[model samples]
Target: MFDTTRRRTLEWLGIGGAASIAGCASQAPTAEDTGASTSTAQSTSTPKPTDTDRVAADPADVPDPISRSESTHHDITLTTEEVVAEIEAGVTFSYMTFDGQVPGPMIRVRQGDTVSLTLENPPESQMGHNVDFHAVYGTGGGAVATTAAPGEANGMEFQARYPGAYIYHCAVTNLDYHISSGMFGMIVVELPEGLPPVDKEFYLGQHEIYTDKGVGESGHHGFSFENMANEQPTYVVFNGEKYPFTPDRYGTLSVEQGERVRVFLVDGGPNYSSNFHPIGNVWSKGYRDGSLEPPIEKHLQTAKVPPGSCFVGEMETPVPERIKLVDHALSRVARRGLLAEIDVAGEERPEIFDPNPDTAGSEDEEGSAY
Candidate 1:
């Protein structure tokens, strides 16, 4: 039944050609046909990638929390580069990224800190790029001052005036195209007192991939302008790949029981809001829109992280189980490949949840609640 539903969904999207619906073929839409920039060399498909072509950013690569009370000035530099990398085992995409990684890098600072940021567009870049930080108080949120063309460098300075997690992304005229192709990241401004410490922290970014090829296609995929304009994404993935942190790809995010964990998520969605939820657990504390202000919501089953927005959610791992991080927009997980995992390892508490016990033989053998 699930396969049948998935097939119908793909067919509705005009995904694969007639014969390539359930399966995939080594073919992709042309750049000219899809309105993708030619920088990625998508005119011709390439063979599957080697180790050097994997571009998914590591989830564990996060900056430590700000521990100081005094404000300070920081210098930050980001380079914009266009690269073609693997999106899945058999699929590839042309990504316009900051520092050559999706969602760029996390920028952390304390409230009232001065930030001098530089954006460099290398000579090899095919499109101009700039950053518009949601935390900045300036023209276009510093986008106007930092718009750099190919081979040029632009700089701007701003004071982190608020305490919140903010999203920074390309603010060019074609920002939707760039962001959907992987050009956004998070900027965390810590409060004066800073946030409560957690046993573990994981940083992740979510964005839709608008590709010309259908899901499961075994070749290079090109950016689709029509799809973007229609807000129909081919894949809604985390960290630039389908189920990137799962055991099948990169290993799961492991932690011990009874530990408190915090996840910082920035949604780079040029379109589509993420119904962020953790299966088998609830957000013990959720800071919506990434605000660390008082009156934090508690015990949320799901939280909406909209496009161009952010979320900071905390979880209490009291039991040993694999918690699945997913967008409650069910189809996105069932079909479009949006998934992450948190593996909690500890002894099972049968009193809380028992898979099998002595009561197993008490019910009717041939009857179920249904």
Candidate 2:
């Protein structure tokens, strides 16, 4: 049977091809889509590639799809602790996180794997939160999974049913509170088996935090999924911490002229949009919205990462140097989100080697954010 919801979302993603969707698509896709549409169908949204549309893709460039695998189970524990006892730091708020990180840890399993998660929330009481995984076997990932009661944590189990990227977050109190409080992450349920691991992978997601500044001691903010569409993160980030915090933890990305760097941006917490920038350019665009679709070739400075998405792109740093990665939104980059570095060194380039800032444009509006 055809799925009307998936059809609408796919069309909106500019999939199937819409050149220049950098602008909005005039009309919405209809339910009549039979999946008979060509993979190369014009977006009817973006500008068609010029007469020189088809670029000769070298077989060497397109690596083979990694063999996906399936395993019986994957179990893990996630905890949220206040770094400084009762005091809140950074944005001056104690957040609900997994494994002590905002976006939590990156978990991968085969298509049919049985993944179990045990959660632990800190003592400081707030709204209760629970896990709701999109890749689970039923009910949009167990939204009915009763939330953890204050200090008490809960456990849930589900089988990976699909072979695409799926999102997991605290769907505790509707789509409102939990998400805004920084409770979300992604699980790449490998297709049956598992996809090949790239040279390097990093997990980052957009987050929304609710806060009010006070002249006295910094007020502890209460983050929730409220006004996420409007109150974007004063800070955007990679993994859990901000820029400098990443290098020592996740380490810096090192690459040569043609090595491929896979950057995985998952949205576990729903709030801010993530902007990822590689020094030179993205060498490959293999997956979109968590599935292995086709190869996209883009060489730009800033890349927008949406929620529930796990986009894999490549980077070929022209020369060895320090490259900066930040949320494309200037304010968040400066405030509470994520920032990091890449070590690109010892490289030489041909005549056409250069960096262009005026490349990719952020065309997507705020409400339909990632």
TM-score of each: 0.86, 0.63
Task: Give the C-alpha lDDT of model 1.
Answer: 0.81
For model 2, the stretches where C-alpha displacement exceeds 4 angstroms are 1-70, 80-91, 120-126, 151-153, 174-177, 214-232, 245-258, 268-272, 275-279, 293-304, 334-338, 350-370
What is candidate 1's lDDT per residue for 33-69, written digit by digit as tens? 2345533345246534443465677878899999998
Candidate 1: TM-score?
0.86
lDDT of 2 by residue, 1-370 (tens): 1122322322333344322121222343232221212122311222222322111111122223436332667677665443211112322443445544456555677677777776655456443445667677655365434245446655677777777666777654334334444566666766654555555555555554443332112333333222243554433445434453335444665555445566666654454445555533453454655664334445545555575555555565545556566566656555564556667666545345533334645565343211
Q: Which 10-residue window of candidate 2 scores lowest in summed lDDT?
A: 51-60
Candidate 1 lDDT trough over 10 residues, lowest sum: 1-10
The lDDT leader among the candidates is 1
